[model samples]
Target: MRSAVVAASLAAVALGITGPAQAAPARTSAATAAAAVTSTAGGSITRSEIIERAQYWVDQGVPYSQSAYYRDPQGRTYRTDCSGMVSMSWHLTTSATTWTLPDYSTQLGSLDDLQPGDALNNVNTHVVLFVGWTDSSHSTATIMEEARPGTNARKTTYSRSYLNSNGFKPYRYDKVVESPVTVPDKGMTNVTAVGDLSGDGVGDVIAVEAATGDLYRYNGPDYVGRSARVKIGYGWDSMSDIVGVGDITGDGVADILAVDAENGNLYRYSGPDYGGRSARVQIGTGWDSMTNLTGVGDITGDGSPDLIAVEKSTGDLYRYSGPDYAGRTARVKIGSGWNIYTSLTGIGDITGDGVADILAVDTETGNLYRYSGPNYNGGTRVQIGTGWDSMTNLTGVGDITGDRVPDLLAVKASTQDLYRYSGPSFPGGSAVQIGSGW
Candidate 1:
């Protein structure tokens, strides 16, 4: 966001001038993991898409300099400085200075108001695209910026102390549209919003009472606790591994899948009509040897939602092709040595990759790791949190709070209390106890 003078300084830096160095986010390569974004100017942008757009420049290794302008893939031109970089990322019609950028954004009161793809601006000094708070304590921030002359557009973490040392103010662009996950009272039922069971856009919780064996659907207000729940089925106490895989029956309505406790057989519960579930239909047999069962949405890139199972004996992971409605197909092995994890659950597409990701808790380290789709190769994990040794169950119940990120439910081993970790929060995770007597 610096002006002509800063541009000149950048030019000098490019021409062999330099200053105190700063570090960029650690990476195995300069290459980016996010896919490229193809967008035109002028329209609402989602937070994930904004990050994708910003990543384009980072992928290109666009250098920081004002003397020359940068042209985006959409053929838009903007200054090569920090603000110009933000302009391109936001897909602004034209480059806006730091002072003028405020015109298109709302100033936030505190760091907690921050979201990915927002901005932190110190007018006339600099502007950086706010990626997100690096930790739950709001102690550090991750940002993408054209940091002065000679430096390339980069992403790195900075301490809150340093960011607040300047006159930085948080701002969210007016046209920014968050992901479907919005917050409190946004159709979140008081009970867990596990997955959409009522064919509504908002996810509905399908919970089985431990003693009564009654399956209840919680739909209506957002988040867990006070939502209205209706008994949908009886005798679910004998079933384990309940999951709401997206529309697997090709019936246009989402269906619930569960494993019968007596047998390892998995059954699909497609509705009798559109309103209520039908009798259990066996789809897969001999699943009793599976250590984990998860219905990951469309992981195969096909229209059908797929499920993954970890072999109880070998610690191997296999994907069951969806539309396997008739019966289980030859399950495909996607990853091996999964037994090292104490738990694994399907988190609906945390990355904007169209395929759902898996969350695994390492048995030895108790580390929680998220593996982005399309496959779970061994080394692909990025550790998101640790100290999860006592977790008895982990369910990623899509997005509940509408934070443009997914929410997770973890049942504690010692207390059986249910804890919720709202989206995009990890490391310094914010675990809010949402329920008890799970």
Candidate 2:
């Protein structure tokens, strides 16, 4: 049971994530017919006239016949599923219930048929709407819909294929839609660790097959295969749990960081190509088992980038002073106790002190510890979460609510619950639960 708890906490920290410059919505095409209008004698109506009709439906929230469906054996009334929620949203947008059936494939085209304001049917269970694009290719797109129980409105990105082929098929209405749908940036995976290795200011991504030691890199837009990986001897073996990304090296260009599990070595991004640059730089040696690693932007007040690493086995924290690692690094031990550390998070100005601070999670107890100035040993420690929960991966920390200071994010893998804590200190604000119970 204890082992299960540790494993759960580690999994969540390994997959937290976020994004870049926002793009404008796609423009509508002229060849299509507006869904709101119907021709009586011959020709089509004007675009502005069709938009006026669609706006009328948007004002009135879509309604359903609660009095019509039968109750299940569990005494729950069948109101709506993922598809039903989407169908309702569509009716609100176009005021048409003509395609209200459970199947969306029959009404839509293949994934390629998708445009803005289109219905995505997993054919059987889920339904999502393509609303906007974020990238050069039409492959990644943003979706807005009522997907879960309490989430009536939410935004997430999906590849055109996962949005289509995961279900039986896709569907598209015959008429014209208000906007053109473009793909989103390579959709951010629940998996974190995305950025460019060439230091071009663009983010690149890398993925490793857990079953085999196969490694892959995401160049501009493609996932190119790299050499087979091997284990580095230390606390564990190999780069089993890893996050691949880029940064500017001494020359201010992008360099890669492939953190290995057992040895905790960082493989620097060599040149422009996504190949292994040089050998791996062994960060630390001894009984320290490194678990989580991250780039902290100039924590030392230097002009170059700095770093923070956490030892899941030992609760020790180390800070890399600047861009180069020629035996120039500083180490600070944060919290002390058996199993006192699980994940580490870097927030620029975490204390709102104009400098970045560090947050460490105690796995055994869901407590959060913060390190304010460069003096890691001087910061206050606070209890963030309690009662039967293990904090894994401090994945995302941002001003999600626009409070100016970022919230601490973690996942409780055992229950599959994502927890967010708003704070600069404890008496830590309330924790809100997000995502399906995890």
Candidate topping TM-score: 1
Best prediction by lDDT: 1
Q: State the lDDT of candidate 1 residue by residue for 260-351, as single tens digits.
A: 65776877777422222256677778765664567676655666777777765666788877766333357888898776665567766555
How far does residue 15 in candidate 1 sit from its true spot (Å)?
35
Instruction: Give per-candidate clash totals.
Output: 14, 23
Model 1 residue 397 lDDT score: 69
lDDT scores for all predictions? 0.61, 0.39
Error of 1 at 256 (Å): 1.5
Which stretches of model 1 miss by more than 4 angstroms? 1-194, 198-201, 220-227, 271-278, 325-329, 425-428
TM-scores for all candidates? 0.52, 0.40
| Model 2 weakest lDDT span, ten residues long | 1-10
